[model samples]
Target: MLAIDGSFLDFKQLDLLALRQTPVHRLDPRAKVLTTLCFIICVVSFDRYQISAMLPFLIYPAVLMAVGDLPFGYIMRKIVIVIPFALMIGLFNPIFDRQVLMQIGSLDIWGGWISCISILIRAILTASAAIILVAITGFPAICEALEKLKMPQTFAVQLLFLYRYIFVLTDEGVRTARARQLRTFGKRGLGIRHFGSLVGHLLLRTWERAERIHMAMLARGFAGEIHSTRRQSHFGRTELLFMGGWISLFILLRLYNAPQLLGGLFTGTMP
Candidate 1:
């Protein structure tokens, strides 16, 4: 019963944070990763005062979040944690660039603030998209995606192996600690010397396991690369149409007049 309960708990937690099985997840990891990179590049390429231009770019991330069924609040919270880093770098702009680029009656709007806001928006969009991508795609898919993208075969394979064995290693460490606890009884747990010894033992065990796995792989002809038999994924017409329509619309708004369009929409000229 205890074992069953533990397994159930682990399964539930994994579902809460683990990757979902959906169309987005089934997409070729390499392609999805590349598209995400392109999206971020497009967003960052816009100059300051590009709020309207950024709107259409928002569609890509939004559709991914919605269709992917990702945990939006969890991803947004991660974004909030990283906001302080951006704020630290951008806060200097207001002090350094004192010249006002625009004015509205008594309020002097500095170019620094505009640039800072631009930086903040780009940072948020890029980070949020990245977190969502990883959350929806899982670590193995990411490693596989990297592998398929012509990344160094050795490096990508190492990541794949590392992720696969991490949990096993962790479980071994936990069991060892429990055994130590049972033996120590009233003794101080995890003292410096004891901790050092435990770490050394864990390292030796991990090395031995790796060696055994390598030998097993050699026996089966690893051939210096890991191979997966999963079918390749491709984007359909719907995805292409969505990407094209949004890219063209955003570029048009950016080149023409973004702020005017936004103002007109707010003022009821266009929805």
Candidate 2:
């Protein structure tokens, strides 16, 4: 049998992790979703140069990963894929803002470098939190949780379909590419002369596949909204405690220069 594609394998791994019986996976999805939203907010709210303030926010994702039994390397690799996008957007900071912010021995730390690193740190923290949330709560449960929290129905429905269509799209792309490869006998595949026709055929094929899926859903009485067989979960005491604890921690981290404070306490040096 052909080995599954690596990208699809990672996707399946996350979905499978959500199906595990860990406590984090079993939390009311609404709670997990809201907490993750808060975590992202706290991390993103830091100043463009406030790298020190961002360090404490790492605790939230770390806890979730540990509690959810998530693989550190797998999640970090997913996070690595996002770093270049952040760098692409923020890389000019050092060139534009070159004021020295600090000195260590013979080295000078530029404010722009600090700010650029800050952006990268914040990106990793926020992205990892999101990945951990999906790993624990899964996509469908998150949609249901959002609906329960009164997210606009249209937006929620669109989100659900968008997430589901990704797999469909990837599958179609891989199969199309594989067929092209087979026909070309590994010498050349889908040359520029044939690119336009292949592009059209790929779209047409994916559309037909989606149409058949829609018809199948209709035959099975799929309503305008996606429904789940999972029982409705409530934000009870456990969820309330979970949300409260994290929010409090996030608030504290947001309001304090945690790194300086802790570093001073430990080493008698203050920034």
Candidate 3:
């Protein structure tokens, strides 16, 4: 499927991006994963009506994007597609809770609209942080980082295998499509009648391909665990500093309102 190709290409691009030797990329994947998890939790913990407070949270992703050399345009585009889903989480607040909060100029501002905007802001902040993390760390390293963090072995192995075989599955599907296309000979072949048989064949092929992969892994002594040779599990001074600094910042941001403080800087109203 064309969609399959597109999905594979997007992942390939992110994987290539992760191979760069930037400082952010060189840091322990645990640092990034832990920081990102904390960031997401903090951002989501904000109330449904706290938008401006979430602004300062953008610093995490912005700095990571710069340090990791990730493409801002790519991240923004992804957030755009995901925005509608996030918006829906609070989009109906205005209709159900129409009690007017205040009057903005000639318009009555509803609490629902404010809450909706807040959810969207939180969504953007959290989504951008995740995208930046994956672009910098790649899925493989993240899995390794999770394993090191004592995540369940079964979950990590499942993730690694899915990533490993998705390519093979896609390739086989593409070949199947090409063969069908060639046999069709400029005719309308893949009609509803052929759909069942076509899907069944693809399923059979996928099973066979999966069995082959299982055998290969067994031959290579997979031993039911996905081993990553790329990252050594170690806690050095730099990693400690990196973790402590960002975590402290997250705690501080959670305790204080950075956005309001910045906003009141020139008005002599800062606390």
TM-score of each: 0.65, 0.87, 0.83
lDDT of 1 by residue, 1-271 (tens): 2453354344334335545677777666665676677777778788765565666566667888888877677567667867998888788888887778889999999878877887788888888778776766666677777777788878888887876786687678778877887888868875888989998999999999999998999999988767787555665775576556655665675466666677888898963
Q: Which residue runs does candidate 1 get wrong by more than 4 Å? A: 1-18, 48-52, 158-223, 235-239, 253-259, 262-271
State residue 52's C-alpha deviation in candidate 3, in Å.
0.7
Clashing residue pairs in candidate 3 are none
Model 3, 1-271: lDDT tens digits are: 6766776667677788888988888888898899889888888898776777777788888898998888888778767767999877877888887878879799998889988888888888888888788888888889888988999978988898788778877787788788888899978796877868878998998788778888998999988776667556466788788878988898888878887887788687877
Candidate 1: C-alpha RMSD after superposition: 6.7
Model 3 poorest 10 in a row by lDDT: 226-235
lDDT (Cα, 0-100) at 122 in candidate 3: 86
Report backbone clashes per prediction.
Answer: 0, 0, 0
Off by over 4 Å in 2: 1-4, 181-197, 222-227, 266-271
Candidate 3 accuracy as TM-score: 0.83
- Please state the error at residue 172 of candidate 1 in Å: 12
Candidate 2 C-alpha lDDT tens digits along 1-271: 0344676758878988888888788789999999999988888888888987888788998988888889999999889888999998789999999899999998988899999999899889989999999999999889888888999878887888888887777777778777777889867664787768778888898789879989999999988766667566767898999999999999998998888899899998876
Error of 3 at 236 (Å): 1.7
Cα-lDDT of candidate 2:
0.86
1 or 3: which has the higher lDDT?
A: 3
Give the top-scoring candidate (lDDT).
2
